[model samples]
Target chain A: MNIWLLIVGVGLVSLCLRASFLVLLRGRQLPERVTSSLGLVPAAVLAALIAPELLYSSVTGTLDVLNPRLVIGLLAAAVAWRTRNVLWTLMVGLGLLLVAQGLGWR
Target chain B: MRHPEDMTEIIPHSPQFRPAFWRGMRAFTPLVPGVVPFSMVAGIAAVQAGFTPAESIAFSLIGYAGSAQLIASQMVTSHAPTVLIVLSSLIVNLRFAMYSASLLPLFVGVPLPRRWLLAYGLTDQAYAVTMGRPVTEPSPAAYYAGAAALMWLTWQSGTAVGALVGAKIPSTWPLDFAVPLSFIALLVPVLQRRPQVFAAIVSAVVAVAAHGLPFRLNLILGAVCGVAVGQLMQRWQAKSV
Candidate 1:
């Protein structure tokens, strides 16, 4: 496989994956069941991605329930829950993360 | 209890497209710091992997997928076969399909060229910011444009800078933290309904349990399970009601 073919192949795969339903499925009849289920895709994907990051330490390969990320994430979650402000939630979460890491809380 | 997704519920005046677009842009601003470093790293990595400046920029534009770019560049540098490189990158990017499917409802009404552009700019961060947006956002096309256009520019410039700058930048800064932080902010508001919560919990558990899955497929597994449960639960609740 030449490098150009590789690029074209991967590009085709990605474009198809991204554009398939996005462009093709427009005005298409989605089943009621599928629409309801698809709504959960964002929640499921986000949680699936977030959980392991917070709970399982990427650096240490250990699952620390008291991982500072988990604790501070919960704090961030609280801010998000109460204020529902994007800026606040990020400021609080990342501020604490930097602070904790800076203070040597591994 | 107002969710960020719900904040735009009542438009003070007549609905317009530009405001929603700017709102999407504003919502994505906080994540820009993180985006710069990640894209820079990929740019740097591509250069280190022997890609010319032009190829590096092309990688960012054509691949447009972050992890896939990183993985592909690394494989290319390691003298890996093109087939292996392509396969690995494809697997890394399988999630985009899910992103595409999820955006269908919001984007189906958008015109042709605009929809094509949106599809081009569908990164994970943009999707999270846009999908987490309120259904009543009036003009999702504008909101998505605002959010994704920034990402497209940031990514392209980041790659160019990193490629041209080339390995001089120290990567020690914990800039990577911002990506997950951005997601957490987006995730909290979606925890509104019981089914959504349940779906999240199931996904979280399975993601952790299957964290060891190869190609990081466990994320997909968890998503599928969570979506299935949420759908079933939604039906059950509707019946009960």
Candidate 2:
């Protein structure tokens, strides 16, 4: 498929998926199971994205339990959970990663 | 007579929505550190995937999503089957459907046209900033417009700039770390309940185990497994109680 065509197709699919419930289910009660599941979607999706990012080395496709990213990611998660402050999380997380790299720790 | 549109009863007047809109916009500001790099990554990745700058912009604007854009272009570059590309991108974006459902309770009073625009602009930042907000705070329509509009603008502009100069960014700079870090910051706060915590743990485990799945199907699988497991946990909790 042409790249432009592909872009459009992706656009249509994304918009349709996004607007599905918002448009279709107006004034209607959602299923009980779905309602609760939706609450978990954000956490679930983020975890799904974050786990691969923090645990796997995309370049080598190997698990890196001791990678700098894993270390700093844990630190960031702790700071985020405790402080609940984005600024601190960024300052501390990025700061630690940079510091680790500077100290010659991979 | 009460209008059906006023189900949430928050948006009784357009005048009241104006401030709410600005508040929503400002609410999304704190997320810039997270979102800007993500879009930049998407833009740069698109160009590296052998797309023309124009086409890259088209994908960014049309796709209007960071992860999906990156995933779609990467799939294209790998000559992955079109069906797989579509499935992968759809899976990546499936959370937006849940976003719509979350916005519904908050946005019950918004009109159809505005809601459509809000839906179009919904992203992780928008959803995170606006979800579960008190009904008395502001009109969801206004706040969502402010937040999602600014976020959409940042994402589109960031992609455009990233496409032009993303190739120059060194891979060693640890820019990608910002994404996981930002997500950590976002995810940590939302994990207030046991079900949420358990769901995240299950998803993390599933995601890592399924990391080798084709076309990043592991993400979709992890998400599905997380939700199912979370629901089951909730059920178990209720049963035990």
- In terms of DockQ, the best-performing candidate is 2
**DockQ numbers for every candidate?**
0.37, 0.54
| RMSD in order of candidates | 8.6, 4.1
- Candidate 2 on B1-241: residue-level lDDT in tens? 2347554533536577778878888888887776676677678778777788778888988888776786676567657666676776776677788777767766666667656777788887788788745567746677777888899888888889978986676767676566567567768877889999888889999989988787767777898898899999998998999
Clash count, one per candidate: 1, 0
CAPRI grade of model 2? medium
> How well does each candidate superpose onto the true structure, as a TM-score?
0.62, 0.78
After the best TM-score superposition of candidate 2, give how far the Cα of residue B166 lies from its true spot, in angstroms: 0.4
**Chain A TM-score vs. truth, each candidate:** 0.73, 0.75
In candidate 2, the residue pairs with backbone N, CA or C atoms under 3 Å apart (3 or more residues apart, or in different chains) clash, namely: none
Q: Residue B133 of model 1: what lDDT?
A: 86
Minimal lDDT window, size 10, model 1 chain A: A23-32
